[model samples]
Target chain A: MLSGKKRGLQSIEFLQAPIISSSASVAGPLESKSSWAEDFDWIMEDYLLGESSWERTETKVLQQVIQIALDKQQLSFEDIEVFLAGDLLDQIISSNYTARELKTPFLGLYGACSTMAEAILIGAMLVEGGFFTRLVAAAGSHHYTAERQFRFPTEQGVQPAPYSQWTATAAGALVLEAQGNGPRVSSITIGRIVDMNQKDANNLGAAMAPAAADTIHRHFLDLNRDSDYYDLVVTGDLGLVGQDLLEELFVQQGVVPKPNISDCGVLLYDGIPEVNAGGSGCGCSACMLCGPLLKKMYRGDLQRLLFVATGALMSPTSTNQGESIPGIAHAVAIEI
Target chain B: MTPDSNEERKKIEEQEYQQLVEQVRPRPNILLNCIWAFIIGGLICTLGQLILDYFRAQGMSMEDAGAMTAVSMIFLGALLTGLGWYDELGKKAGAGSIIPITGFANAIVASAMEYKREGYIFGVGARIFSIAGPTLLFGFVAAVIIGLVKYLTMLW
Candidate 1:
């Protein structure tokens, strides 16, 4: 089991199990009143955060969040060897601009809302492979920026369909070191693109649900574990609608993940009806994992967690071109 | 389960999954939305008529009063859009708010306000007509064809 080879179909067992030293989560004002607000490190008073543009505020949040994590452990930029960060922007602008400020060796990733998990899994692999002793995995998203980029402008008067998700204006950063005293990255399942020709952008949960189910199913298959293996299996940004679809998928596959299975998107809102379906974007799960979930782990309330971040990989251009939305989900298992 | 080896089976499976999704997904109540649209839209039209009547009572000609009512309605729509209330209205009113001339004004002002940050020339100027452009294009085409038919009928 400790062999440095691929374990199953699409999973990798990190022999070294890179440790998470410290983490920080920051969200916009919209999330300040959320159920888990107290768990967050900080919440901005406004989406702009006094910046002229939403993009700038997103970059500032990403940069400041990484610093916040490092500050918690008395670490500095010189202590980090690599930075893996991403955002939901045209070119991952927030991460790129933040990287330029930090001047750290960087890798910019784009997995849409799955960015946080994608970055974490890759960072864990690199640390276990002895590539670097220290790396930072971070991701963030802004509601306003995502609005103009994906849908219409923030102020544009288009009524959101009942199935539409509220893109979270949030970010999270975690410090991953080869050795530390915290939860360890035990294993990961890299997802595949699962597209059922679902073309409705307003219903991202539907488009992304299949990919989440596929990744989660394969994770269990590779680990040869039951639904009760992990203390909890939480999917990223699969709001209420996606959660229901996933339930059906589980029933079909003879998997009863009830009571243990949950969704970050649905939990983030905590019955905030105006959010339509629920919270989404990369930050939806990032903050959940870095904030409340991690606190639960530290408190020994949880022993094992499977964080499967789902993403609908479709751009406005692709939608206009009549292409279906393809979805992907990456799973990272953390054990304390 | 492993990826199905049979292509036909995979297609059928995908279809089944979508069907399952449909069963679970929530739908907007069509009847409720229609009712709200009817009420809100009717109120907006009634407001316009009230304005026309007020102008006509001032001894203004019928044509002048009608033109003033159109201007007043557009002004109100644009102001509401700027104040961000029009969109809130739009959420409930749906096609009821959209079928009138005020809806046309809302469409244009909304685009301009949204694109203001991108700049004047390329942003507001180029994109101002984005939402209402199609309506104007179709209106012109229909008008030209109808006028041509009327002229030919008169000659006949």
Candidate 2:
């Protein structure tokens, strides 16, 4: 029912979802010894040395995105009505800090890895519902900062499994405005949490694939549309293992879409050689959407697209309680 | 009177009774605590070493191992936290668990567990950002400030 507006008359059909303008930034990995202690020290020194914490990194990325969008769009901070954001850290620190700087009304969201999509979906709804004219949906992640809080310090020596996805050290932002002439957010498919209690945290790709497939399948069902309509279907940060698992799952469900299915995790690390598999974390999809994908769209590389960001809803306590991990995925359709 | 007195004397008898109290308490086992500390701590470190070896075997550079090790430890810590074993082990060996990289992992998972019952919106979802949240905010602000400082310094 949503359509682009014409220049003359402000028809209801002309009212479309806001356009998204994105930006991103990150700190490089520290150069140090393989010992956990040394690694932690180096990361602490390089990234967290002067800053009070990692949440600042998320704020910095958000700020960068906002700065770029402000410059590109030639808009001021006061023009934005809502700032909806999320991150992987506890308490949604990235959004909070960034909100403080921008001084805009904020809606803090937490969908883990699916945070990017969740923010976008909410922003679109606000615009579609005629609540706000301009909204920003942003998310971010930091490597060393995340490492020190979620894992061991570099000083300790530990081994990572091959299946584990690297948390992308980046943040991305999108400025959505109710402009008539631009790509419109066509449809949104919210996800249900599916828990299967498979405790191989290293193989998160497998753990999350079923949920991703479920969401993707359900989105098509709800929209009653064929998969070939969109030029690309993207999932947030499943890494190589997750991508394979998702393909296999789709096949099992007798819903084989084209090979155009790509993952943000795989795309973000396209040029970065040392990065093992692909990206993970809340920022993975956020960065890709704002960075490469948006750039591609701007360059007229493709047209209609589907973005499904998936998340694993597992807590340390749930894992200990012998509870299975629940996965959720949300899909948003955008067209140029 | 003599007969009555004799009968009265013969009828007299005496008895004594005593009450005793016993206390029950568990004895501290130093050896047991020591064994747990050494065994669990050593095992965690060993697992980390094995991960390092695996990464090396897979042709990852040594430089990358440090980052990889932290990632592995996070997963291990999360697993241990989930299994209800890390806290028990941590209790048995205080510094042993606390000193390792897994401690941070334990903090994250433990904080997450504390808030998990609140549902995704306020529970696990909100808590995931607990420890890392502040760290990220500070890092981002610092980066921007640092960037500004560098820019200003260049101009000067």
Candidate 3:
């Protein structure tokens, strides 16, 4: 019971659960127009963030999110035991550079788009194991920065494929404490790398959908729970195509997950036109969870929910070398 | 681990990985992409022709009109990129955007704008050609090759 492991699935049931004490999220212009716009603590009028490059802007976002989260809790960076953060950039410079400025004990993660959830899962585990009392989990991604790294330069006038999702420019950070009045991290299901040989870098949704389904299925078997146990089940950024595929795969596997399943990618740009497929990137789900979803939990709107953050773990080098895209997903159950 | 074992393991993993990928990913819709590119690229070339015609009607020689049209089109492309409209077009046009001369201009200005924060000299001036540098380099190289061929044929 003290040990977090369950069955043979390597799942963690946080015996000494940690509370999601407080959180803050900041978004760029396009994300600010999403349904969760009002939930964001701050939204930049421009993507610049007063910096020259989108990479620098993303770093500024992570820095601001950490500071804002700390401020809301009436604490400082010194109060947190560790800062877990990452982003989609070369060498994860966005999080690396931001951590340097924050001056906190940092553990840089690179789960691609799943960095936020991975950070939170690890942060919650550490806190619940009595290793630390307070920790911060954060991640960020900028559309321009990501585009330049994974595809062509934004100004290169290269066209994206139809299934391509717009990389969301946003940053989200959460403060997890050993005990608090906020939501609790009940359990976590870490996913395996499920590469379905999707070679197209533009269509990340297809590459990542299988990973999401695999993780969700594993979470159910490990916990020995049915779909009705949770109010809603959501994926990171499956977009329109991935969402459809996820539903089809779940049915094929005879795993009828709660029908309320939705993707942050599909929701981030609901009415925003021209954002083909939908929103994808580390920020897509991170911003949604930290902003709107957390607000709903605070208002007693949702008692239990599953947040399965997915990531396409392919690099420019791998894709160019004709390697198929590998995808991973990590799920965490949160309850108020 | 031994080198032989490591290499063998890597090969097996790669093979298995490919098999897994085949199960999940759907086939790409290339027909749709071709249609979009065809329409957008045709429209851009048509616009260029109209610009050239207008300049020609204004009493300019055909050569002068063509040159002026190219200049104006390049200017329009750069301006559109600055206003962030070119990228919107790019999302739909795919190769269509890259095939046009305007797309070339868009590439230069876009890089310049992105690096503007680094300052005028190092950011804007230095990195301005990062995207278009190869295009210019090879374009001149090909022109020289073609010119050399024509001269050689005449001599023969």
Of the two candidates 2 and 3, the one with more favorable lDDT, higher being better, is 3
Candidate that would win on DockQ: 1
Give the DockQ-based CAPRI class for model 3.
Answer: acceptable
A32-97 in candidate 3: lDDT tens per residue?
A: 887778899999889886786677789999899889988998988789889899888878898899
Task: Choose 2 or 3, whichever is better by DockQ.
Answer: 3
Q: By descending DockQ, how would the candidates be arranged?
A: 1, 3, 2
Clash number for model 3?
Answer: 2
Interface RMSD of every predicted model, in angstroms: 1.6, 21.3, 3.8
Lowest lDDT block of 10, candidate 3 chain A: A1-10
The sequence of per-residue lDDT tens digits that candidate 2 reaches over residues B63-125 is 798679879898988887877677656655755686577866776677676554467778877
Residue ranges of candidate 1 with Cα displaced over 4 Å: A1-3, A256-259, B1-5, B154-156
Best by TM-score: 1
Pairing residues by index, what is the TM-score of model 1?
A: 0.95
Residue-by-residue lDDT tens digits, candidate 2, A192-261: 8754445655556666777788788877766666767778999997777778767766766778555369
